[model samples]
Target: MNFTPALPKPFTEIWREAYRYNEKDSPRKSSYQAPGKTPVPFILGTTKLTGGFSVDTSEYPTMGYWSNVPRNEKPQTLLVTGYLRGDNYIKERNTLIESLRILTSDEDPGYLELPLWGRFPVIVTNWDVSESGGKNGQCEVSIGLTRTGMPELQRRDTTGVMGLFNKLENTADSLKDAAVLAFESAVDGINAPDTIADSFTQIKTSLLDIAGRIQGSRSSLNEITGGLSSITNLLAQGERNPRKLASALFDSGKQIVDGIIKIRDTFDDPELFFTIKDNVKNMLQQLLGVKNFFLDVDTVTIKQQVIKEEAERLFKITAFSAASQLMTKLEDPTFSQINSYWKLLQDLEGSINMDDTNIYTAVQEIFMTVAEELSSKNIAAELTTFIKTPIPLPFLAQMLSCDEKKLRRLNNFSDSFLVEGEVIYV
Candidate 1:
């Protein structure tokens, strides 16, 4: 009998049919699929591969024998090894050698392609090549690659020269404000009287008026003070600029002279006059002395030299004069006193130039000391009176039992006065 038994389907075909049947019966079919093409077995920048190739990956262990807890995983490292062979193996090897050299030399990481794992960005930590003695034209290379996870960013500049300049500018501005505030405070201190008398009140009002004029000037004293805020600002502008600081100082000095003139004019006005008692005359003389201290004898010449140090020196002198005047004004026995004037004088003296040091030490000391001494004595040689008839100074000195020269020294008199109604102090 030549009859053949019926053969079963091929194993692959039978498996496919069985799989189709199972897939229909199940809720869903498994959709797993294999990759379409294998990756090229070569580093992107290197020669073609001929021999067996391998890729190695390693993970650092975070687990310790004593601990059950798992720590975060570390970055992975890959090791690659391959060979090149052919008629042009030498040329190919040279190309690969050159490529490896370039990759290793760069600071930045490079891309790598593998036959099995796909492409990755990696750093070539180390690389080496070997050649056999036989001229079969083949060479081997091994490369160590580390995964470049997240790139590190560069740091920024914070404390540079520009930053330092800004800091200095701000500091200079603050110092300038502090100086202005000190000046204003000193002015307030001088203006405040311990006891309100008619003459003192008038003088205080006149001083306030003068201050008002200074504050209201085209280039105000306040603005001038602000001009000194920064050396840079001073060097820049005109009105509030550094170069104009001297002009502002000059204006201040002129205003002070004008104020003194106004106060002097009041002395001749009958409407402002009071009984010229010894104490009253002393107070008036002190007022005149204070006013005289602010007289700018050469403001025009001073304004020509717009130097910073000169302007600062002038300011100190003005402040000192004002303080001295205040000291004299507050010398009345009825006033509750303070030593602030003396303190301000000392501070100003330290700031002023040594060449200009004599005015405060000589003129103020001589007159003030004599006045204070005479005030302490309280020897009433004659009843306080406002005289209408003029008398000789010699006769008056004789009446007070004081030598004429001694009286002149004590009175700070440069010239003999027609004794008129002015009270004489012995």
Candidate 2:
């Protein structure tokens, strides 16, 4: 039930909340809520700061060694040069050292808040803290941070296409891990072999549908099918260990999803592009559609509840990732189609019927991406204007100031007059 902490805007909402994503002692808090009344400043004070941003890209051999797919936004990297000071040098040095220890080695990522850049969930990929005799009661520190994209039970927001993709990639990975954990938990709670076998059948059916849709895709279908086959055989042989089976299932699911994403790199065909994305999305929906009788029967067990919760989260996360890639892949997307994507996302949210605010955050970022990027190029592409009254075709000729024949052909008008004024697409 953890979320990336809510960031109203990168600079405006600089003061944010603090909560534990994995804390079991207390009921989980919303990622959108600001619980901490005060801001938690970095232990080190900055003297000078440096920052970076980049696009995550893959060179496509199929498109050509030099060609690449639409760039995914890379997490912004930070290099902060700062210092620690205290009345006692040893105490100040120890405090900074311990913070660095957790920053560098911990499995869970720690939050790094810059003065104006906004708070980020980050991993200290590399850092240095040093002290000298000349500089008594103080030490120089330089830290390198890469946004890990994994917010440990916190909400977050940032601007730019880079931030969107960075968070998306991490969220997708997080969703995968959570899905596996939930599946494993469910497997442990329900020991009935028949129930397990039926669930596996449902999984296989979903995978096969996806396999059929992507029949000619460059993705490795055989690999996905092969992994699932091995597990199905093992389950048939009375190998019912929950952990092992769940891990294998998780690997297979990830393999299929990874392969699906990889197919986008194979070639550029708009029709196939949408076909594959839609089919895979439908397969995921089907995967979620199957009713697990075991979950229903085991209502008394809380593990089942976790399984259901994770499934819902997984669904939304999957949709978010798919929408991100789709929007990015387009060279120039129209406001009409962008609006359609918004509708699809909204419908998805409505289907899930959960009151999660994080989905709306992702939606806003995507909508803004289209609006801001398109604003400068051609305002015409984004909006349309029309009248209810009928008008002659020659009326456009005089109004548009274009060559009459060309305008008429472009408008696809069969009659000499338009019954009602329409904003021509061109």
- Estimate, for each residue in 1-426, the C-alpha lDDT of model 1 and write its tens digit: 111122223323454443345645532121111122222232222322222224222221222212121222445666777776677777766665555555431235455654233344555667777888984677777777665544332111332334333333333233233334333332332322211122222333333444443222233434433432332233234223322333333334334433333343334434433321132233323333332322222223322222223334445444444334333333232211223334434555555553322232332332343245334433334223455677788777777575676455344444486565555443
TM-score of each: 0.22, 0.39
Backbone clash pairs for candidate 2 read 3-154, 4-154, 4-155, 4-156, 5-154, 5-155, 5-156, 6-155, 21-153, 390-419
What C-alpha lDDT, on a 0 to 100 scale, does residue 95 get in candidate 2?
Answer: 56
Model 1: lDDT to the true structure: 0.40
lDDT of 2 by residue, 243-297 (tens): 5555555455555555556664563455575465444444444333332212222
How far off is residue 77 in model 2, in Å?
19
